[model samples]
Target: MIQKQNPENERIKRKFFAYLQGPLGRDEKTIQKHADAIAWFEKTTGHKSFKKFHIDQATKFRTQLQTATNARTGKPLTASTMDGQVRMLKTYFVWLSQQHGYKSRISHTDAEYFNLSRAERRIAHTPKRKQVASLQQCKRAFDLMPSATLIQRRDKALFACFMLTGIRDGAAASLPLSCVDLDEALIYQDARLMQTKAAKTITSYFLPVDPAYEVCFIEWVSYLQNELLFGHDDPVFPKPEIAVGENGFQVAGLSRDFYSNASKIREVVKSAFTSAGFAAFAPHSLRSTLTRWADKHYSSREAFKAFSQNLGHESVVTTVGSYCPVDEERQGELIRGE
Candidate 1:
């Protein structure tokens, strides 16, 4: 039962999260970001009724948040961070205006004040350079990984999978052995089972990074099948288990479904990169690295289709718009090389 919430705003937030999860089709990460902003605002206002919300409350909160220093950076929060909080708040209130109990109290127009000014919005929304691991850096990191245990082998294979396929981490977590066809030399990224981005699905074949990694991919599939006894229906990257060690506390070891989440994959990635003396890169960065590689390796129509297919993107133009941004240093390198 949804308990009587807040005699104030508690009921509203739960509903908002539901809408975000359901109709919005938002990923958990996005819902969490929006939920966090609302929670902070509610806590700041001492659980005040949403019916009493006003522009003044928004202004005061914005001011307070502006002077606050980032816990990680130790500098006053900039327009960007403040802007994100404000933006989420605005959207929530706009959503609030349409809800059953709130239609009269909140106006769609009132939420407009929660917005950053035009110039501030520009600063807040500006795209920054995304860091990705280059293919060479990835290879060095993969080579450094010690495949001592089943978990270790899986971690190494996880790195190779990212470099080879450019699949998103969550989708990677949900990949099933049946979707892979080593004999056919392709992996079917079918969204019906996998948690593909925006639910887009496509088949991705191996890139030209290294022919040798092909054997590693085959071995990984074989290990899942013959040794682990995983069936075609099982996750490609199975989750490691947590059980009591000799000391009687929980210890994690290779046990079985790709992580219920992506944290384990992230942890293994950082460890491998640090071991290889390469900069730590998130799994998504592999996409950017592949895009850059395609820019140099292929030309015209072929490059477009190659990168588009690599990303599961529906259009080559969309791929270029999203990933083909040429930074100044990289631009200089390209001009100099040619």
Candidate 2:
């Protein structure tokens, strides 16, 4: 249900968003997340104006958030999620305390109440090893994806594209046919059009996976050009065409344009993995697989630096810091080997 909008709260939120965009230089997605955090806090406070904020309200909300359950899952939110919510609220309060109308009413020290206890902060920040499918497993899933219809063929090809290039899903969705260089086995993710993180344009070559994976990707290119009559400027992975059917609106075929977002690419990956009798992995996990593979294959710093660059990382540290969590099995292997 839509919460009743408070004009006072809404007006203040507009200024907050403006502050994030202008001085802070936060992106739209980041600003939106902060907006959501503010909305959640407002909801808890019965849409109370910021000018009315007090230390008691901050303390109460912090306690209430600990017991709060996810509306969708009906389970308590994870510490990391709770941590983000609290951080967002704290940042807002700090900012609120400095604002004109709120300054005298709200004290900067009151924002400290939003901080998670030390133990909770430790739990929230600890690195957890994320699951990444091996190259062999990804190839199996790609093969298992049926190509009975145009949509199936497109989905199978989409999975192949991810495996072959390790391009982020959004970049994959935004790829023009021209960006795919079949002769070079390279995908040029031009940030000029594609939604690359940090708007970094990258040239990623196909990984040293099985020949079959490359064949699948190559066949997809042929299918798009020859079968679908897609041109140089056409989207490499087009969105599904939706139309009214006998039952209701159903996907008919591949549309002639790119997906507005990467959600469909993610859905295709999840469904493909499930059908192949594997736990679903997000599309981004493919990058981790590639990273781990590089960790094993590359010994020289230059080689690894090149590997990082291929994944669009400006610095090797950024790549390793984010995706280099060794799983228990890998950790055991490393320990035993040495």
Candidate 3:
């Protein structure tokens, strides 16, 4: 049976969403996740009114969340997943405890019931092994990518660009040709012009990867400028233009416009890696690869700091703490003084 939503809950949810977007400065995707978390709590309570919110309800929700299964994997939700969802709910309820009608009913301390056990919290915070490509693996993938047509050339260039510069997928998707400097080997990820994380303006220098990757990227840029007559304002990686052909709608050539999002860029990266007989590595994994590379090559602290800054990280600690997780094999080797 379909459970009916409380009108009061819906009204307050809209207000909370606005608070998230306006006051909290959350993006649409993040706001949606917050909404989903709230909805999950509502579902647990049979769409009960916020005015009726109690400590027991939160306890019940947390207990159910512990055993919840992921719809996609058909496996029990991971500690991390449950942790995130619970945290979101806990935050929401804490906020609710201060709101007008909810203040008297929901105590601030009541939200503590949503927390996981100490052991579960520790497990949730543990970082999992990330899938990062080797520099050689990236080179092999780049070499194997066919560059027969303009689309193929673009695909190959895009793959090379990711390796040559550890730019995020969103930034790369919206990057303008003018932002790229072939002579300087730099990328100006200007937030005013392109999509950057947290609207940060980053100055990224191309990493010293394979020279072949740089050559491929340079040739692609030259082709766009000289042969295609593409202007500086055009997208660095434009979507393919679709036109009606004998077989129906088909890709004609490069479009002058930027992609609406980074979905296509991720697809290209995944295809390139998989086709080259490697596990499908997302564009973000390339950042990890670069981080690992920096760990090995940059002997001096100053050089490593500069390298971290080039990757758009404010602090070297942020880069190391987030990206430089040693695999178990490497950890074992290090322990043995190998």
Candidate 4:
């Protein structure tokens, strides 16, 4: 039997979401995650009222979540996934406990029941190694891509741009031609003009990956300006114009508009790598690739710090802690005092 959503619970949830957005300054994606976590708790408790939330309810919800299987995967949810959901619920209840109607019924102490065990928390926080493409591998992929047609040229350039700039795919997709300066080899990720993580205005200089990448990007920009007459405000990598023909909808050429999002840009990257007989590495992994490259090439601490800054990180620690990982071979060599 389907359970109906409680109107009172729905009203409070909406209020909480607004608080998260207005006071907490959370983005849409984060607010959605919070909503999902709250929905999960409500579903487990048969849409119980937030005003009636109790420690016992939270305890029951945790137990049920632990045993729950993902509908899509048919496998038990990972410790990290469960941990995140519980953490969100804990935060929500903590906030709820202070609200006018929920104050007497819910207490801050009650929210502790939503926390996962310490063992599960450890698993959730542990950092796993990510797959990052090497400079050589990226170059090989670029070489393998055919750039005879306009669409092909854009694809090749977009792939090269990721390696050259180490820009996040989201920022890259929304960049206008004016944001990139070929002479300076820099990208201005203006938050007001484009979508950036945390709405940060980041100035990212091109990393010293390979000159070929810079050359490819520069040529593409020149073509956009000279041949296509694309203005400074035009997207660096425009979405392809699709129109109906005898063969039905097909790509005609380039449009002077940004991609709706980074998904299509990621698709171009994945196809390039797979075509070159390499595993499909997302464009974001290029940041890690640049980090690894800097670790090898930059000998001085100052030089490395500057490189980290070029990647739009305010601190070198953020760059190394997040992107730098010791491969098995390197880890073994260090352990052996080699």
Per-candidate TM-scores read 0.83, 0.88, 0.94, 0.95
Q: After superposition, how far is residue 302 of candidate 1 from its true place, in Å?
A: 5.7
Residue lDDT tens for model 4, 187-259: 8888888888889888877776788888889999999999999998999999989999999999999988798
What lDDT score belongs to each candidate, Candidate 1 first? 0.80, 0.85, 0.89, 0.89
Best by TM-score: 4
lDDT preference between candidates 3 and 4, better one: 3
> How far in Å is the alpha carbon of 119 misplaced in model 4?
1.7
Error of 4 at 233 (Å): 2.3
lDDT of 1 by residue, 14-34 (tens): 888899889988888888899
Clashing pairs in model 3? none
Pairs of residues clashing in candidate 4: none
The lDDT-based order of candidates, best leading, equals: 3, 4, 2, 1
Q: Give the per-residue lDDT digits (tens) of candidate 2, residues 288-319.
A: 88788888788999999988988988899988
Question: Weakest 10 consecutive residues, lDDT, candidate 1?
Answer: 1-10
Model 4: weakest 10-residue lDDT segment is: 48-57
Model 3 spans > 4 angstroms off? 1-3
Q: What TM-score number comes out for model 3?
A: 0.94
Worst 10 residues of 2 by lDDT: 207-216
The segments of candidate 2 whose C-alpha lies over 4 angstroms from its true place after superposition are: 1-6, 242-253, 336-338
Clashing pairs in 2: none
Question: So what's the TM-score on candidate 4?
Answer: 0.95
